[model samples]
Target: MKQKMIDVSIHLFDKKGFTETSIQEIVDELGVTKGTFYYYFTNKQELLTTIHLNFIEFLLKKQEEILQDEAKDSREKLRAMIYMVLQSINERKKSARIFFREMRNLGPKYLEQNVEKRDQFRKNLQQLVEEGIHKGEFQEDLHADMVTRGILGMTNWSYYWYNPEGDVSAEELTDIYVEILLNGINKSD
Candidate 1:
């Protein structure tokens, strides 16, 4: 029941925007009384916070698993991590949209908690970039923090425009992104 409300809310939030969506509308969509919603979530804001946490926590867990693998090395781990982000966008488009677009609607307490988790993810990626540099997999002078932000910025924004079923598959798009991130756009001699 809790999951149902969240799933429905994500669809509504994605299509209608958080501020525009109402608790009444969510209950109506669920064909349940407001009491039922109250039972599962304290209020609409709590539900939104839950949604935000679920999305980012899912991401952080997957990234941790990828980072822990010993055989992949920095480059493979990087590819897998980017691919994971793209795949999550592809697979959970509605939730991804809500997670990115509806974050501003969360209350101060909720926003701070979400930001901490988000920052941890960014720091973990920076660590990976530093690992790559240390092992000579990436450039020595690279600013890992900036590189981490650039990789995140480039991939995370794809939720707005990337088409999973269009001309390119997710794997193919991952290859293109990895190529660009690792090699850049400059022509080699």
Candidate 2:
């Protein structure tokens, strides 16, 4: 029941902005009573916070798994991370959209919690960049933190425009992004 509410809420939230979505709408969509919602969640904001926390926590766990793999190099780890996010866009499109778009709706306490997880995810990417630089896979002169941000910025923004059913596959998009990150798009005449 809790998961059902979350799934329906994610769809509604993705379609209608968080501020625009009412508890009545969510329960009506599920054909449940408001009491049902109150039984699980204290209020709509709590529901939103749960969605935010679950999304970031899930991503963080996946990221940690990718980073912990011993056989893959830093480049492979980076590619895997990009693919993970892109794949999420394909598999959990509504959830991803809500996660990115409605995050600001969370109150201060929830906002702080999600921010920490977000920062940890970014720091993991930064460390990966630093590792790549240390191993000479990436350019040494580049700022690791800035490059990390660039990689994240490019991939994260895909949720806004990427169509899972489009001609481009997630694997293909991952390749393009990884290539652009490692080797710029400039022609080397």
Candidate 1 at 14: error in angstroms?
0.8
Cα-based TM-score, every candidate: 0.97, 0.95
Tell how far residue 119 is off in model 1, in angstroms: 0.7
Q: For candidate 1, list the clashing residue pairs, or say none.
A: none
Indicate the worst ten consecutive residues by lDDT in candidate 2: 88-97
Candidate 1, after superposition: displacement of residue 179 in Å? 1.0
Error in Å for residue 43 of model 2: 1.0
- Each prediction's Cα lDDT score? 0.92, 0.89
Over the stretch 1-189, how does candidate 2's per-residue lDDT look in tens digits? 999999999988888889999999999999999999999999998999898888888888999999999999999999999999888766777878888888888888678988899899999989988998899988889888888888889988998899868999999999999898878899999
State the local distance difference test value for candidate 2: 0.89
lDDT per residue, candidate 1, 31-133, as tens digits? 9999999999877889999988998999999999999999999999999999999999779898888888888888886899999999999999999999999
